[model samples]
Structures are given as C-alpha cells and as structure tokens.
Target: MKFITLSNGVKMPILGYGTFTMSNDETERCVTEAIQVGYRLIDTAQAYRNEEGVGNAIVKCGVSREELFITTKIWVENAGYEKAKRSLEESLKKLQTEYIDLVLIHQAFNDYYGTWKALEEAYKSGKVRAIGVSNFYPDRFMDLVTFSEINPMINQLETHVFQQHKNDKKFLEKYGTKLEAWAPFARGSHGIFENEVLMQIAKQHNKTIGQVALRFLIQNGIIAIPKSVHKNRMEENLNIFDFSLSNENIKKIEELDLGENVFMDHENAEDIERFFKMFKIGNK
Candidate 1:
C-alpha cells in the first residue's frame, strides 16, 4: 500500500476500507476480511452507525492498534464545537480506540465551522491524528480552508471514472489538501464496471475494471476506499499495486470524466432538499 503525507504531516494510506451504508454485522465481517487482506486504513462514519463493528474488528484483527489507521466522520446532527467534540468521544468509545487516525466533517451542512473548531480542538488534544471535510465543493471548500486556523488536511468526494473532480483536484493541490474518493466506483451506478474504454484498459492489463478505476485514482495521489462484502472482491480491490497505468492509459481514463457529479449535486437546491430528507436531523 502507498501513503500520502497530508499538509499536517500525517501519513495516510493511499487506499483504505470504506464502510458506508453498511449494517453493523456487515461492517464487522467485511472490515475483518479487509484487514486480513492487508488493509491498514479503516474508514467509518458516525452516520454509518457501524463504528462499533469497526472497533470490534480492530480488537480481533490480530493487528496492533498502533499499526492501523482508523477514521470516522462527524455527522450533521453533531455539527458544532461542543457537539462535535462530544460526538467524537462517543465515536472513540464505539470504535474502541483512544485516538482516531483521521476525523472528517461528513458534509457541509449544519454548523460545520463549529464542527471544524471541535476537530481542531481534538487535534490539539491528541484525540485525532488528522482533520478534514467530506463532500466539500470548490467554493465551500475554499471558504472553509481560507479562514481555517489549520488548513484542512484532506477533502473526501465522490470521484470516479465518470465524475472525476478535475477542477477540484487542481485547487486541492494548489491549497495543499489531499483528495480522497468515497465511492471510487460511482457505487457501480454509472456503468463504470463495464464501460467500453475501461473494459479495454482492464483487458490490456489483465485487471478488473474496479482495480483499474482504483489504480487510476491512487496513481493521481487520490486516496480511494472501495468497499465490498465479498472477500474475493475485497482482495481484488487491494491488488492493484503490482501494475502501473501508462500516461496514455491515464489520458484515456481522464477523458471519461462527465465533468459533473454522477451522484446528487450538492450545490443544487432541489437536490439538497431531497438529499437531506434521507436524514432526519435539524428539524427535517
């Protein structure tokens, strides 16, 4: 596995295990297999409600707590200085760890500034190794990073073959923030698994399209966390380190970018309304 040093000097694994929309049982099983297959970076979020499972896996993975990088997010409900700090303590208990490797604001909603302040405090106290934001677009991202006492170490987004944050990447690099991809396969919702171009590239390298997709992001210095319940597929997601994509291969994949988010547009008023409805916080 490769590593990227965040602006804050934290070494984060370039590829990790993501636990999103997973049941507690599923998280326990899959995270266990993922660790056994050589994954040291484990990502879970308070919204995912599976941190307990992740914590359980950590205790049973036979890997020392110091060797693993555990990450979780502060959800919208817990989006302020006091609440964020309190929530992280709850997360640490659920995750069964004294300190988390990384902690991120799950979204741009609620009192994210307050949430960031809490994260900063956590950082100062040595409870979190690094701090960041997820799903922050270019404008919102710049605003937060500008006034932040400590610039965000990373920004997690929905980056994949179709919706490759081309402009976002440019600015993140300019501001010295690392970009992490949440759904590296577009949740397999974008025909990405069998896209003609990606399939061709995969055949040439004898790699699965999933591996090719993840490799492209990792080679570009983006941290990618591809999730799967199947042990074999989990193993496949971690096996992309052996092959390299040539410049031409990288160019071909780059052209596949849709230039827009393949998932919901966080900037759209209508989309935001519907998306937030999925969660029942903040008087919704």
Candidate 2:
C-alpha cells in the first residue's frame, strides 16, 4: 500500500475501505474480510451507526491496533463543540481504540465550526492523529481554512472520473490539504464501469475499469476509499499498485472528466434540501 503524509506529518494509506450505508453486522463482516485482503485504513461514521461493528472487526481481525488506521466522522446531529466531543468519545469506544488515525466532520451542515473545534481539541489531546471535513465545497472549505486555527489535513468529497474535482484539488493545494474521494467510483454511475476509455485503459493494463478508475485518482494524489461487500471485489480494489498509467493513457482518461458533480450538488440549495430530507435533518 502507498502512503501520503498529511500536513501534520501523519502518514496515511493512499487506499482505504469505506463503510457507508452499512449495517453493524455488514460492517463487521466486510471490514474483517477487507483487513484480511490487506486494507489497513477503515472509515466509518456516526451517521453510519456501524462503528461498533468496526470495533468488533478490529478485535477480531488479529491486526495490532497500531498497524491499522481507523477513521470516523461527526454527524450533523452531533455538530457542536460539546456534542461533537462527546461523539468522538463514543466513536473511540465504538472503534475500540485509544486514538483514531483520522476524524472528519461528516458534512458542512449544523455547527461544523464547533465540530471542527472539537476535532481540533481531540487532535491536541492525542485522541486523533488527523482532522478533516467531508462533502465541503471550495467556498465553504476556503472559509474554514481561512478562519480556523489549524488547516484541515484532508477533505473527503464525491470524486470520480465523471466528477474529478480538479478545481477543488487545486484550491486544496493552497492549504496543504489532501483531497480524498468518498465515492471514488461515483457509485458506478455514468456507466463508469463500461466506459470505453476506462475499458481500454484497463485492457491495456490487464486491469478492471474500477481498478483503473481508482488508479487514476490515486495517481493524481487523491486518496480513494472504495467500498465493496464482496471479498473478491475488495481484493480487486486493493490490487491497483502493480502497473502504472502512462501519460498518454492519463490524458485519455482525463478527457473523460465532465468537470461537474454527477451526484448531489452541495452548492445547490435544492439539492441541499433534498439531502436534508434524505438524512432526516430537514428540521436542523
């Protein structure tokens, strides 16, 4: 596995396993298999409600706590200095660890500034090695970095071939924050798996389209956490380090970028309303 050093000098695996929308039982089972398949970074969230499952897998995976990188997020409902701090404690207990490798504010909603303060405190207290935010767009991201005491070490977004987030990447560069892709596959949207460009590249490298997609992101210095319930797919996702994509091949794939988010648009008010409804935080 490859590693990237965050602004704070913490080395993080370039690839990781994300457990979103997973039940506790599914998270435990899949996380166990993912670890067996050689994944060291495990991302969970308070919204996912499966940190306990991740904890179970941690104890069961037979890997030492020091060797694994565990990440969890503060949900919108837990978005305050007190609430977020309390949530972190709960997450640490659920993850069965004294210190988390990373902790991110799950979204830009609620009192994220307060949540960030909580994370900052957690970082100073040695409870978390790194702190970041998820789903924050450029404007909001810049605002936070400008005002915050500590710049974010990372920002997780819905990055994929279709929505490459090139502008965001460049913007984050100014702050020395690494860009991470949450839905690195775009959840298989936009015919990503069957795209001729990715297909051709995969054929050239004797790899799968998913592997090529992830390789593209990782090659561009973006951290990717692709999730799969199947062990074979999990293994396939991790087997992206063997070959390299040529510059010409990268250009072909780069043309595949539509340069806009194919998923939820965080900048759109209508989309934000829908998101709130979906997450049942409309009243928040």
lDDT of each: 0.91, 0.92
For residues 81-150, what per-residue lDDT tens digits would candidate 1 score against the true structure?
Answer: 9999899999999999999999999999889999999999999999999999999997888889889898
> Cα deviation in Å at residue 63, candidate 2?
0.6
lDDT per residue (tens digit) for residues 1-284 in model 2:
99999999999999999999899999999999999999999989999999999999999899998889998999999998999999888998988889999999889988999999999999999999999999988778988998999999999998999888888899898998999999999998899888999998899889999999999999999999999999999999999999999999988988888877876888788988888888899455
What candidate 2 gets wrong by more than 4 Å, as runs, is 282-284
- Return the TM-score for candidate 2, rounded to 2 decimals: 0.98
| Superposition error at 106 for model 1 (Å) | 0.4
How many clashes in each candidate?
Answer: 0, 0
User: TM-score, each model?
Assistant: 0.98, 0.98
